[model samples]
Target chain A: MNLLVDAFAWIFDPAHQAGANGIPTRLVQHLGISLLVLLVASAIAIPVGYLIGHTGKGRTLAVSLTGGFRSLPTLGLLIILALWLGVGLEAPLIALIVLAVPPILAGAYSGFEAVDRRTIDAARAVGMTEWQIVSKVEVPLGLPLLIGGLRSGTLQIIATATLADYVGAGGLGHFIFVGQKSNDYPQMLAGSLLVIALALLSEGIFALLQKLVVPRGVVANQSTDVRRPSSRRVAVVGFPTEERK
Target chain B: MNWVIENLPLIGQRTLEHLALSIPPIVLSFVLSVPIGWLANRYRWSRGVLLTVLGLLYAIPSLPLFVVLPIILGTGLRDSVNVIVALTLYGIALMVRTTADALGSVSSDVTQSATAMGFSPWTRFWRVDLPLAGPVLLAGIRVVAVSTVSLVTVGAVLGIKSLGLLFTDGLQRNIVAEVATGMVATIALALVIDFALVLAGRMLMPWTRTVSPKRERRALPVDEAVTA
Candidate 1:
């Protein structure tokens, strides 16, 4: 309780807000960098995933391989990229994008895969073109999972992007690295709280966005979300939850 | 290749440290998560709350978590315990939900039949539920293993000095090989474990490996249409 109070005080302190190290400034950097990674990842992964899902060729292999990206240590990659690319935004930005792609890709293609085979067959029966079926039927139906993937990717980037500090890319991690060096636990905790808050807020916003975008008829019920929960997004990289009939 | 061969000893020691740092947390979290998962599965009311809490814990960024953990545990930043505990939290965060899902995946009919036979609840879970849930649970474990392996590298920042130390040191010295080596080794660890788990899951659940008649039905029709 006391710790929480102190942590809040640290954030709200005017003394802390006037410098290069101000919380507001750092939060913008954090959100900026994280949003950049999210946009790039979504742009790259979603279309590729959709194509794989539509073609149903190389889908499994692509997803599993992307899942491999999840296990590459972000810190290690950040340092390595920074070393090679030099200590600008390139290192952390590239690393976070790579980190963000897998789940989005998995969510996308899997969402495509998750659509009922019968639905595609029915669309074909109605004389819909392949692209029409994809755009009109598959993507709309796959939107929840696709958004779920974006949600997971966004969550992952925001959470891990703190490592940007390691390469001096400059984010909320600035407070943390500096605080930890100076043994400022309150300051560190405050930064962590902000990170957690951002992640949860994004998660909440995405969930609500998913609810708004997904058609009432497409998802049978909310229970489906639970059973799949972004298709084991939190667990395995390509960890597809076996779909319940 | 020359660099790797020349520095095999340094790599080997770091790899060992990496293993030591990653494995215990996974094993420990798996041990702890089983009961918690069971409780979540058995009690409907607790399921949402339980998994949500774990998810939130996982959402906490690792660096912050790493820095904050020592304070929570009253340990030093350099303590190996900090890494272990942080990784364990992540492991439990992931595995608990999957564990519950695995248990839930057990068909109710199987449990009902087991119940009809007068097996104790304990016997039902151990004999029927757990074994049936093994494949899914194993799938989840593979994820946890890979994730933990990657996350253990984050420990390098706080000076726990696993293979990730190579990455950090390599960065500082502008040595690409060391960073590349560390990244490769860490990724290799994850892939090997992932593949091994797949094979092990197949071995444990042989039925899943063989083509099911239901799948064969779909495949034949899809194949015929493609050919025609």
Candidate 2:
């Protein structure tokens, strides 16, 4: 009980709230790294995923890549990159980018996959151009699932960024590692609390975004969001619960 | 490579420890999830609350959970039990949803037939619903197995013994071979376990094998359990 009290006290201690190593700075560092990684990952992954989902050409590539990457442990990869790159942000940044790609890619392609095939054909039948079908129809309808991919990717990055400190990158994980070394249990607990709060905050924001992007008429269909909760989102990448309708 | 040869015993011991920590959560969570999954699927209102809460739980990272569990459980910081409990919670969060979805995947006509045939709900679940839900349930369990095996490695960050020890130990010593060995060993364990689960699923649910592919496609996207 006292341990809990002390940890809360440590977090609220105004001393811990300001300065280079303070909670706010650590929080920003964590969110900043995660956001950067997600943006870059989305830029790379969304294009490729969109291409695959649009063309239906490289699904085999997406599946194998995500499966292989999913099994690769974050700690092992971070250590290998750190060992190879010799610290600084490069190691963790590269590792996080590699890990973040799969979910976003899965989301992009699966969002397209979730769209009814007839809907695409109908867009074509109505005399729309190929690009028009993609941009005006597919993109609008797929937005929710794409955002879902981002949500899970954001959640995964935030969680894994906490491990970034192990490779000498900045994040709230610094406190946990430092506390672990010095046997400062309260500090460790506080760090854990901060990371959890960040993860939940992102989850909430993404859930709302997913709901908002549902493309008003499409929301009534119940096709896209059917198993959204059941898909192995959040921690693991891909393995989205299969579309049932 | 030579480093791996020299550390074979250490690697083997760590692999065993990893399995020891992993198996309980996978099994226990599956046992706990089925009923909870049934309850959620049985009642409309419970599904939203159950899935949302569990989803939030899953969103929390494994590392933080490791550090915080000891505080809650009053165990030593290094206790393997903390990893077990944390992983079990994660497993439950994952499997409960899968279980509910798997049960949901069972066709209503079949269930209605069983009820019409004079079998009670209990008998229907055992003889019809569960068995019919078997393929999807197996898919969910296989995922749980692979991920559980992989996640046990994270426990090493807190100084808990598992295959993850090699990463931390190797990093500290700057032995790339040792770290590489840890990665290989962890993936190999996950693959082997995944394969075993598939084989077990085949043997236990032989009817799934003979089900026609056209019907199979219409019924469920079982392969998505691996590929999404």
Candidate 3:
């Protein structure tokens, strides 16, 4: 109990506000590194995902490999990259980009795949080129899922970025590492709370983003089907029509 | 290469340790999640709070959690247990949301018809809802299992002997072979775990297999309508 209070007090203390080093300045530095990692990851992944989804060829293999990459432990990856790249923020950043890629790719592929086939066909029937169908139709329709993947990926990168402290790339993780070494419970808790707050804030922001971007038509379709009178009348006479559809 | 032959025994021991740490969490989380999911669904407002907490939990970085646990729980297995507890918390959050979403996806008519047929709420849930929701729930579980297998390595960072220690030590010592061995072992474990879950998903949810036939037939018209 005292530990919790002490930790809170330490965090709020003006003298300790940024650590012996400027705290806000250090946090922004960490955040900048994290965002840079995420941006690079997104740039690599979104294009690859878009290509795979648009082409719809070898998507299974591409997605499977990406999933496999995602499952590789980030700590292990960080260690390996640190060894190969010789530490600093760059190694961890590279490792995180690899970690982030899979989800973004999978989300993009699946989202595009889920785009109503009719919509794609409708576009094609009107003589829309393949590029046009993708950029205008499939991409727009798939934007929500892609964004969801980005949201998840961003959160993941931020959470995992703390591990970078082990390699001398400073962030909130510095507090955690230093606290662990010194047995400073308050400092450790302060860092943990900051991470928790960051995570929740990001999730809320993304959920709101999803609300803003996801097509209204898709939402209406999902809810309206739920509310249909016939939905309540299940005869068990047959499987759900929508399932078949 | 010589390191491989010399450390063969260590590699085997590490594999066993990795499996020990990873398997228990996956199984424990699965067993706990089903009931917790049901409870969350039963309570409305609390469900929202529970999920919010879980989402936050899921976002927690593993290393911080590792360090924080010792402060609260002393050290050693107690610390590891904290990791498990944290993982389980995240697992329940994911499972509950997925389970609820799958259950919600079940058509209302199916529920109404089951109710009309004199099936009790318990019976409807067990015989109907559980079976239909099995695949979706399994998908979530599969994800959790793979992730937990990877996470067990992080558990090793806090002096829990497992594959992570091998990798961490190898990197520190610049023992390339040990690092390779650990990476290979971890990846192999992930693949095996994932394969086992996929097989289990298929066996437990036979409906998943049968549903495809009808879906294929419906695809033809949907395809045609779109093309036209």
Predicted model with the maximum DockQ: 1
RMSD of each: 7.8, 8.3, 5.8
State which candidate has the highest lDDT.
2
Compared to the true structure, candidate 2 yields what TM-score? 0.91
TM-score of chain A of each: 0.87, 0.89, 0.88
Per-prediction fnat: 0.60, 0.57, 0.40
Give the CAPRI rating of model 1. acceptable
For each candidate, the DockQ is 0.41, 0.37, 0.37
- Would you list the rank order by lDDT, best first? 2, 1, 3
Instruction: Provide the clash count, candidate 2.
Output: 1
State how far residue B145 of model 1 sits from its true place (Å). Answer: 0.4
The sequence of per-residue lDDT tens digits that candidate 3 reaches over residues A1-245 is 57778878988889866544656865786688778977888888888888888778879798678667756877788787788888687888887788888888888888888888888889999999998998888887888889889988887788777777777788877777687678776887888777666767778888898889888866665542222234323345556664422
What tens-digit string does per-residue lDDT give for candidate 1 at A1-245?
A: 56667788998899878667888888899999988888888899999999899998887688667767778888878887888788888888988998899899988998899889999999999999999999999999898889988888898898778888888988888877787789886887788778878888887888789889999887664462243222222434353475322
lDDT of 3 by residue, B50-156 (tens): 67777767776766666566556665433557767666666666787777667766666788789999999999999887787788888888888778878778765
Model 2, A1-245: lDDT tens per residue? 78889899999999998999999999999988998999899999999998999999989989888777767888998998899999889999999899899989999998888889999999999999999988998888888888888887888799889999987897999999999999999999999999998999999988887777677787777652222233322444445354332
TM-score of 1: 0.87
The CAPRI quality class of candidate 3 comes to acceptable
Off by over 4 Å in 1: A1-6, A221-245, B195-228
lDDT score for residue A86 of model 3: 85
